[model samples]
Target: MSSLLKPFSISDGPCESGAFRHGVGCSKSLHSPAFDPTISHGATAPGCRTGTTRTRLGCTPGIYHTYSARRTLAAASTGGRKVTHPGKAILAGGIAGAIEICITFPTEYVKTQLQLDERANPPRYRGIGDCVKLTVQDHGYRGLYRGLSSLLYGSIPKSAVRFGTFEMLANPMRDETGRLDNTRSLWCGLGAGMAEAILVVCPMETLKVKFIHDQVSLAPRYRGFFHGVREIIRDQGVRGIYQGLTATVLKQGSNQAIRFYVMNSLRNWYKGDDPRGEMHPIVTAVFGATAGAASVFGNTPLDVVKTRMQGLEAHRYSNTVDCAFQILRNEGPVAFYKGTVPRLGRVCLDVAIVFVIYEEVVKLLNNVWLTD
Candidate 1:
């Protein structure tokens, strides 16, 4: 009995959780008792926790093994440590915004030109290349970046606010299972989009359209970024900076809602079990492109309305409704899809690049900050 109990006394680490099977097989000894040492010595399983039990019982030589519970990692925990830093979303979003504008501003310029061209008129340029060529011919190659300053000034904050809001909304709205479900993600995006639209996107888009559409001559009305902003405020008051608030809200809200929903779906599909699994950059880019494409198709009509409403000549229309009606009446339904090709190209590539850069920057920042 002493020898049989000796095996159970070995001090393994404390078992927080596990199943301990007590296999007591008594020997067929009518007069004497037989003890099994193997059964007395409990074997620990990976995730099993067994409480200490010292019983002086007689049993046959049966092997005893601990069955471990499946240990699941939390959603926020990564390979190194749990996520502790809250600024990661802002930093990542800001960096991605800056990079995206710099790389895709040219395409954006061309797309805007295509969208803003008056259908009733003979047309300012034949097509996308012609538009580009004419702009270069008239205002030089730098014309492609006519409104870059406005976007640069607003993009950082806009993206920061958008992503920050997304994180805030998503964390709280996550499902009971601690997973960010598609519906919650969509709501998160919608909230982020609306926040950004009201705070930064509306004004930035207004300025961008004013700069791009109102081409600058030697002595233009709106001289530069600051001057343009001042003129808009002076002429239209603070309201001028948010000329297309309604259209912008619709466009941005739908944009982010679709983007986040699709992106979340793709990411979850890729990382089936592990929510925090790190995907390759290429895979991230592909997912981002898919999301972007979906968003573009979903909101391009609203984007067109927004652009028209924010243009310098927006006063011609009373509001978003009037603008949409005018476009349908004057330019036909096809007008709603202006710049589809260029926009699709720019947006897909832009999203892919932005997400790749954003994820990489966040990872690097995590290393730099040693987030735990």
Candidate 2:
């Protein structure tokens, strides 16, 4: 009888030689008689606990195995971390945005200036270098960050909405192995982009462009961020701050879609089957820069239109469609890529910094926040 009762491994289950090896615990010892092999393998023993632990003493191997497999699947699917809460994502994204914008605002200023320079007879600045030179000559080097306050104010909420919405959308789309395929990643990014555009980006972007345009004007009217906002509202009404809703939505949607799709692809390729894989900061930067460059190429035309629509001279066009038509008709096709170079530099660095910071912050948060 003793020989017959010796522990034996169940090849198909988490239990090995009648011991709970997958972290599930049992109140009674596995070597006890409750685990008698003669009892039907599927039947519940008199002393066995219910739920996942039921199989600890071999009372229900089938159900416990299924539960264990599901746990394994979930861990893999989520990269062994809890799905980031919206609040945590918001904090991480905001930090990343603030840091990134500060570092890259000069390039942003140059890009906006080029985009707004519509004088065909004599372009305001020859190119990126000329734009920078002229800006420094006219307003000093600090001129390169003329409208940074508005952007800084908007960056926090813009990134918060972007990352929070992405996590919310992506949590459900991951496959059994916890991988987000390119198609699903693109959809998630698109959803996040649209969310940010509507929630925080449109008015913020409009204000930033107006500020930069005002700064360059012969007689700048706005005194500062608050004064400028109030004046804009007084003159153009609340609608002033939401000048380029359509173009912004299109640009931002495509921007994030391309960025996230590329980032996801690169990450998945790097990590292979290990969702929990950690990346070196350099590797993350490379992936982010690549993603940013892709987005810049994919949506620069839309960005040009968006900038024009939100600039101080927006009233020339009747609407978003008219705005695009006017640029195409008057400035020609090359005009659509007016600030591509400055934008490329800004966006690549911007994305690289943002991803590295955001990921690092998220990792720190995950360490402190316990998840089941």
Number of the top-ranking candidate, with lDDT as the measure = 2
lDDT of 1 by residue, 171-211 (tens): 66655444687888899899999999999999999999988
- Give the alpha carbon lDDT tens digit for every residue of 1-372 in model 2: 875687433432544443443346432223312333433434345666543234444545444455456656765656554366777888999999999999999999989988998956577788888988988998898888888999999999999999999998987777655678899999999999999998899999999999999988889999999999999999989899999999999999999999999999999999986876789999999999999999999999999999999998899889999998988889899999989999999999999999999989999998897554
lDDT of 1: 0.79
Clashing pairs in 2: 77-178
**lDDT for each candidate structure:** 0.79, 0.85
Instruction: List the candidates' TM-scores in order.
Output: 0.78, 0.82
